[model samples]
Target: MTAASRQMKLGAFLWATGHHIAAWRHPKAYVTAGIDIDHYIQLARTAEAAKFDMVFCEDAAGLREANVAIASQTSRSIGFEPISLLSALAVQTSRIGLVSTASTSYNEPYGLARTFLSLDHLSGGRAGWNLVTSASPIEAANFGSTGLRPHADRYERAREFAEVVTGLWRGNPDGAPGHDGQSFSVRDPLDLPRSPQGAPVLVQAGASDVGRDLAARTADVVFTAAQTFEEAKAFYDDLKGRLAAYGREPDDIKIMPGVAPVVAETAAQAQEKYEELQELIPDDVGVALLSSYLSIADLWRYPIDGPLPELPPSEGMQSRQALVIEQSRRDNLSIRQLARHFAGARGHWRIVGTAAEIADELQARFEGGAADGFNVMPSFFPGELDAFATLVVPELQRRGLFRKDYEGRTLRDHLGLKRPM
Candidate 1:
């Protein structure tokens, strides 16, 4: 697509309170957001009104932090289950897509396929699934597993899991002899009709090599994290390049890296707003958050003022760990400094500026071939989401980088994705 014709796709990444680690502590933040259905309903309506492509939700099967003290200080431990939350939001909003993360690690193909397909019909085809392999041990323990599976083994299961789900979604009716794989055995087709937009959009956020390959094979949308233009571009090109091997074109998939933006009427105000949130993060909470992503439990053992220690590869979030390590070394940041930095945005690219400045950065990335779009991560809910909608979105619309109004009813049309046969 030509530059003028290609508009950036945006997903409102909805988290309770906000995406920042210290969001729930912000005075303006609604601390009770986790239990407030009206809060999410209002946020969804706001995104729909702003013509966002979708509102994405993340999920985990268990507690986010293992340490009770650390977990108590933050709001990550409390939130609505994403699928249930989105199902509720489906009836409340009419336009924006509702996408939720579900794990292949803990769910079977037949059940997962049926659930998302039902959601697609309920939302009039505005449903998506963000595929993830449950990487955290805390989640693993919940399912009575002996331990977390190795990274490669998890992805292998995911590969088979995705194939079965997609086949079921396509209405495969051969049930006499059904799929019998290493991890799953299925004997019947899904007891559901074909999806309204052919099938609910398939989304993935695996950035490791194996993860990227899985995404290229089946994902319609890929969410990623990158802190620099070079990193984002490299990932965008690599993933898009792998598509041809699967008999798919580059345009077949959308690559939208997560972007955490703190926007205000002025640059100084935006910075001030970000600093205010930053100051709310406690030292232990910051370190604990970093440790969880790094897949290590005793990060607190390291000297806070010292540089990051050499570490083994992470089986949890390999891509995220690598990103954190790169940043720490490149900037020569100490443990405390790195923790504070990543704790704010959770390892995604962060931009703090006025509406025009935020728009300028997004435009450069979109037009510079670094991204097909962005999954916008607001620092706090309601207020920050409102700021992006009222301030930055109009600036993007004026430059023709984003849609000013809904031109299509389903998420497929909004994303310009082809309706699968």
Candidate 2:
């Protein structure tokens, strides 16, 4: 299909409460949704009703924040394990895909493969794995490591781990298969038969150089955090370009950037909503969150309105650090200003507008060849998700930019992605 004709695939990136850092603090958002199965079921059904290609759940092996000070202040300390949550969500909704995040740094290939394979079967072929190399040092500690693994080493292990997982997914038709890889040695074949769509879709959300290469080589869907059209296009072009070298076609992988959009009846109302959420974030909380995200020196040391001093070197989240720094320099934002800015989408594109306006932004990106689609990160849950489904989705449908209804049963079918042999 041509770019304009290709339907924009949509995935609801469901975070606890919402994508905004202070989303839980919002009056309309349910603060305890992280542990509430009913809340997730409602969200899933809502997205399914809107014909979303998938409902994505992000995970971290350890507490996301650095310390009890930040962790206690933040609402992110609590959440369900992704695989278990998605497995339960599978029974609650049909047609809408269930995509869950897991870390290669902490999980073994065999266990991950088995769990996802079972989820695909349980969901009737609507499961996707968002493969991530755990970035937090806290995650490493949970796995008995003293510190974060080197970036290159982590991706190396990930490459091998993914290979083993896919190899196991392609279990022998006649005989058992064995895999001996640098990271894992699997002597026994997977006992599970292929699910309806053959295997769970492979999704990756890494933007660093090593991460991008890994995504190009293995990801069926690439989730990204692109802030601008130029950045998105650059990433899209770079990723699609790498597919040829891997003996993969351009269409083999889909790039879906994370976009957190706030929708309302009018432009003013949307801006008001966006600002309201931003205002809820305490300066200290926002700055701390920004510091952790960029993994640079604590910005609290610098004056809130003063020019950002030289960023300290970071061995953590290089691409994100660059993105944040570039944005700060480009906009000449103060420390407090950048904190509030990051609070909304945590560096993902945050669009505040009406339904038609949101649709316009999505269509522009899709038609501009900056994105195949987007993983929509609503600023707040239930409320924001409902608004998008009720307001924005129809506009997209009207413009023929999105599907009116699910055309097929499997996730691959929803995304128009080919099943692997």
Candidate 3:
């Protein structure tokens, strides 16, 4: 079927606290949930209840924080390893796609391939890989390195790594026994049978130029944070155009942006709920972190309400840093407001309204060629996500905007994506 023919796909981007920076601080969401396997289990089941295509988990290679960032930072660190957690979920939940992020910069390709291959087998093809070339400085030191890898260079390495991984999978047929044994080098392949999909679906999330090229070559799905119609359509057109160069079709890669919704019965209630959640952010900390991400020194150098600081020439984190600064400048957001906004990656796109209203925004993007689907990060999870599943999902189903029930068992099936051989 053509892109125009398929219904829009939906995947929930699950964080330990549930997307909002202070989600765990919420009254209903389990603050202790990040470390608990049951938290993810509940989340996966919730998503399946909504007929969402998958549940995606973002991972980082290095430790984020020891005490504060570590203890409270369920997202960047200190959660069950994604594949392991998802493996457990595979036994409990049947339909939702399980996506795990693994960085190409810090990991060995052979190891990652084997692990995800095992997950694919275990989940019966409900597995998807969210490929990331991590952009954190803190992660470098933990790996016995002092500096972050160059951005473009990371993508270059990722392209090669993907080639090797997929090549390893190329020999294995779906549900058939086979092995290359590059890591173990054992010619006999008897441990586990071949996975149902042959290989896990490849998903990538980077808007960088180098990132885009790698996605065109290796990814079955590409994720971005663009939310607006014009931006989404432009990216969709540009990416689809590039696929032919890789000897692939435009339909081969699907583009999705992140969406965070705060839904209530009334628009006023939704906005109020979002603001209430916003109040929990730490102002000074956000300013410091945001400034450092853009490589600016002393965010305290500027007033809380002052203009965003100009960043230095790009060393490695180029367009990414510029985007944040430029967004700050364009919106004229203060540090406090910015922090609250980033409570859920503020710039990604926030839908504040009733379920019908939120559905309208989603439909607009899909019809406008802005998205093949969305990476939904809820504002306050478990409860907020529960609201989404209970209230908003039916509205989407009413409009034929999302799945009323899962069509197929595997992640690829839910996305209307064919498994790549």
Candidate 4:
């Protein structure tokens, strides 16, 4: 296909019950979806049936909630380890890609390499790694660290960590000796056949400057959160611009922004569905969730009708902090409004509309230089996911904006990504 004729690549961003913070409480949602392997299997099968390029599972090193109080009100703390979950899904599905998020901060490069390589082999070249530097203080405490390593320091380690992991994945062609790096030293040969599509597709989700640079140098698929067309375009331009400096082409990296869609037969129905989930967010839960993402002082002290409080400096999630701040200011949203917004998609974009409307947004973003595609995050599991497949996929296919059927067996082929040499 010609460049203009290239179909958009889609992936399912599989969260516990759904992407919406309150999805677990929705009447139709599977509240126990996190622990239900059958739920994930069905979702995976649905995505594959919809010809989705991949199914992505994000992971956290510790309980993602702010405290036991907030944790009690939500199901964020429950889930399967991504690799184990994806490995199980591998045998049950044949076409959709399986991507799992794991922290480079807590993992050994050799072990991660072996795990993903084995996964790629097992799945017959349908594996990917979503590299992350553990960002939560709770995650730090679990690892016996007093606090998170400074952002810059963590990225430094991650840069070296990624280098070591990729080098290990590359293996020694001569099979003559071991490899050594500042972050990792491995003396054993991989002793495995090259996967059908080479190494697992390297995916990254960081948006900070250091993170972007690391992705430019290494990631084949870059997952991001862009709340608007302009910002998404800016990010697309900046990251693509960095490729030449790394001796890589712009096409080397595919940018897929996360979008949570609340789809229904009409705009009214869509909003009804969206509002139902929003209403499920208890005030305390909303405040706590937004506060965690802002990584500043607690938000409960701020007046609901007043402007957002001036945030304290956070060594936590810097990119998300800036996005939330800009959004609040630009939209003139009060603390209450901001809290609800964050609860919707954290920092990712949300589209509440008919299936055609959702497809229109994706098409505009893709052709408008804002994204190569989207990582579809449904507002509620099974139900919303089913809606998108039954309604939206056909709309895109009819418009020739997406695929109607699988054109290739491996995720790399589906995404038009080349095998790593």
Please write out the lDDT profile of model 4 over residues 1-421, one tens digit for every residue.
5777878889998999888888888889999997899999999999999999999999998998757988888888888999999999999999999999999889988788889988988898899999999888888888889878899988888888888777767766777336576666778767677777877899999999999999999999999999999999999999999999999988888999999888999899999888888988888888888888888646888888889888777888788789999999999998888888889888899999999899999999999998998999988888989999999999999998898888788888888887777
Candidate that would win on TM-score: 1
lDDT of 2 by residue, 1-421 (tens): 7755789999999998888888888999999998899999999999999999999999998888876776776789898888889889999998899999998988899999999999999999999999988778878888899987788888999999999888788777766557777787877887788878978899998898889899889999999988899999999999999999899999999899999899999999999998898889888888888888878546788898876677776778888889999999999999899988987888999899999998999999999989999999998888999999999999999999999988899999998888889
Which model is ahead, 1 or 2, in terms of TM-score? 1
Candidate 3's C-alpha runs over 4 A off are 2-5, 65-77, 172-192, 292-297, 315-319
- Candidate achieving the largest lDDT: 1
Sorting all predicted structures by lDDT, with the top scorer first, yields: 1, 2, 4, 3
RMSD of 3: 3.5
The parts of candidate 1 lying over 4 Å away from their true place are: 173-177
RMSD of each: 1.0, 1.2, 3.5, 1.2
Q: TM-scores of all models?
A: 0.98, 0.98, 0.90, 0.98
The positional error of residue 149 in candidate 3, measured at the CA in angstroms, is 1.9
**Residue 294, model 1, lDDT:** 89
Model 3 C-alpha lDDT per residue in residues 319-398, reported as the tens digit of each score: 55656766677688886566556545645777889998999999988887778888888876688889999998899888
Clashes of each: 0, 0, 0, 0
lDDT score for candidate 3 against the true structure: 0.74
The deviation in Å at residue 82 for candidate 3 is 1.2
